[model samples]
Target: MSELPAGLHDDQTNSEPIVTAHSFLVQQADLEREAAEVLPGKFDECTYDKGYIRQPLYACLTCTHPPSNYQRTKPDASAETAPAGMCYSCSIECHTGHEVIELFAKREFQCDCGTARLLPAGEGSCCELKSTRKMLAKFANTKNSYNHNFWGFYCRCDTFYNPDDEAVMIQCFICNDWYHDRCIGKAPDEGDYEDYICRECVAKHDVLRCIDTTLVFRGVVADGVDRQVEVVDAEENKAENTEERPSKKAKTSACRLLPDTVSQPMDLFMVDGWKNDICTCTGCIKKIETQKLEFLLDSDEIVEPEMDDTRGESLYESAMKKLQGMDRTRAVDAASAYHAMSIKLKEYLRPFASAGKVVTQQDISKFFDEQKQQTH
Candidate 1:
């Protein structure tokens, strides 16, 4: 069986939907079957004991009081301890109204009486901290940081985490934050994943394979001596790539410019002349490569596996010797997306292609554009 590339693996997402751009190609029944195969069982329901023991941050279920370790005692003569604790809202919502006993700060756990289904249904039974959904059994706050909004959890981007069932999300092994696959520009194919590390961690280590190859090495040949040299001057290296194209002078600017589509008066200016120009930067080159891969996948052309390209592999290995810690994780991501697109595109456009008419580029482009819009 083929294995996922090193440093790239699928997350254990439980019952959450795996959102892919190509999902529209599959039937609803087929998706449900796939989900069943991966999940095999229902999502584990959250409980008071589980949340209090595991989660570091939590708020009262009945009220808006901030998360605390105050535990309220049961009013019965037996003096049995309530499983959880509550905040100010829990008192007004049910505790005080029900003549519940005073709360004593228990350093170990919070008040869980709210989770026992003690309060009668109505205004008092509703929890201010959680959703009004009828199925919610326990209150939980696994968020690394606190936020007053409905989205309690936070992504690595430092933004509130919003769950979108239609967007594929991958969990980072280092930070444990979930990020949408598209946002990261790296997504896995349809398969079980066991681990993953975010780009931020990889970037911080300065190991990402994103170097200007043209500026690397330039040396004179010597007699009987194989000499390796490192070039230091940035301008000297930059000029080497530009010397051949003296007539095609690139516009030099101190600030980054944006296209007219995105307007920001304070920061960016619309550069109409440079709009059509192509960038040969390392990042842009990778973008072009990914786009070409996408194009090939959409066209139903054969996408040769990267492993089959010996020459390219040799070059990659040579570059890795020069640029240490380079991995095939990005290549694996690209390949996965390519294979998925190829399969889904072929299935979706088979009818149109077999209708005795030539399918044009516009037809394919428009079809995918519509599909992407629908997903959003």
Candidate 2:
């Protein structure tokens, strides 16, 4: 047995095969548990009608290729297909076979799947599009924003994100784009901050500069080190995000809370609960109002992991809970039988482990068949 994938036991000699099978079982169970923790909700219903709630989104690369980013691409004379995002149900149903990139959750976005922007109901359109359709939009949702993340890229480096990579990426609270710590600039590894305003968002919204240095760690490189903005500049009406970019008149007339000496936009790693410290004095209130900065003070603007009573329970836990609810005598008898069967199954698999052979579903079935034969 050469080197195994990261989590496998290393001390195997003759028992490598059995150990490998055991490791596989453990890994599978762990994966199930992790998935349950992250996504416990039923993804049966289309979310388009809910209207701009924060929800997990997937980029259907099958329909639109990334800046060469996610999933299987449809061949074309042009690679300029506009990026479109789908909801969880659309990802599984409408674009099942396509290479998809999980974008996690985006705030205030409606699913573009089966809409005129993605693939409408027509010949060679998305499968199941007609079945569970949200009323097709005539155009892309102007309110929905796009970044390189929609195209399966992240950070200022425009690197395609590999989830397995060891590099840590943090999401900017404002734009919701991820950034590697090193790409943004040097900062302390152990520093505590939950709300990060990326350099681009910071540049677009100059009011963030007024955040006290004592409450935030600035990801400031040299004055000339340029961080590229993935989306259009404020000069254009194109939506990167409606909130972050301001019109010319609003920009010049907005509250000037910062000192005249501080001119450039830089990353602000805002400490948790720093929102409470924002000035509410008469002058600052005018600035907040001018810039539509009331959301800054609103704690509801913060995104948190979603939970509901409808979340599904894992099979193992459901079974265990059922067993617990039974009378004591019945529970003990069932547990004992389960333990004995488990032991026998392990024994049957022992030879394979010792021989360094792989155990398949058929092997487990054969063991059960032998047990049935003995019982007969």
Candidate 3:
């Protein structure tokens, strides 16, 4: 095992054999499946070399802005110590066991781990990769943008986020801020939207409201109903036979296509494949450039969902698949055992979950050992 993070060390004043248990395979498998949903990406190297780009980040409170140890947070910690974000690799390899905040994916940032940007966590730099981590001369990234999220607040309501909350929070495709359905005047029961643009972004960017209506769309809201496209087709030029019709109807600019402003403050839901339909004509490109929204041109500006190949099969899933290929008698026995054990595990965990108590490592190990003894 690697050295413990700063402020953590086991004393050897009385030498006692430290025996590690290896009986939590079932629990580990379940965690792997859950973790894959949150983060399933390459973590081999630090993303300092990648420069400023949209990537997953973790805010190391211990390394830069140490949170209060009395279960209270320091007010205005953002100004106390500069907010530092680390890439996925650095989050695991460098700041393991630190009080890190997973900032999901943030836009335009480079890893600050072990760099001069982040104050040393303790005696040395805040990185495990000593040989390779850069000691940058730069103190802090001037171009990097900061928000309430750095201080652990989010959405228009500016409430502290809690994962256990029943209310669902969705990320806006435009600005990447998380929002609750009710906060945005959206009903929680409203069917899933392909992409959501917060009201602030919609009103700020004229380009969004004025996307050329002629462009083909897979899902479009017309007359408060969704129209699914069955074929590649554009809206018919309404003025084709009129004298006011221009000689070249196809040459119309995006701004002219929908030459009307939406004065209402409401969230905009985008259709499937809406990004692909963005008018890429020279005139449209020029308009987008002038607004300093070149990031919109990059398809990756919106974080892509993890692909199946990258999200390798979990241990439980692998076991289930293998059981299917086994003989009927063996498969039946394994399936029965699996289902019974899962129910028992859920019952064991219910009390902790209900009481809002954390299920410790020791609890999991003890539960599995007791099950083994009972079975024997």
For model 2, what is the error of residue 320's alpha carbon versus the real structure, in angstroms, after optimal superposition? 15
User: Which rank order by lDDT, best down to worst?
Assistant: 2, 3, 1
lDDT of 2 by residue, 96-166 (tens): 66778888777778888877778743454443444445456455677787877887888887787887988
Query: Which of 1 and 3 is ahead in lDDT?
Result: 3
Q: How big is the RMSD of model 2?
A: 11.3
Best-matching candidate per lDDT: 2
lDDT score for candidate 1 against the true structure = 0.36
Candidate 2 vs 3: which has more TM-score: 2
TM-score of 1: 0.21
TM-score for each candidate, following the candidate numbering: 0.21, 0.57, 0.56
lDDT of each: 0.36, 0.63, 0.60
Q: What's the residue-level lDDT of 141 in candidate 3?
A: 64
104-151 in candidate 1: lDDT tens per residue?
A: 221223324334323223553534433433434443323222222212
**Candidate 3 ranges beyond 4 A from true positions:** 1-44, 66-79, 120-139, 187-192, 212-256, 276-284, 301-376
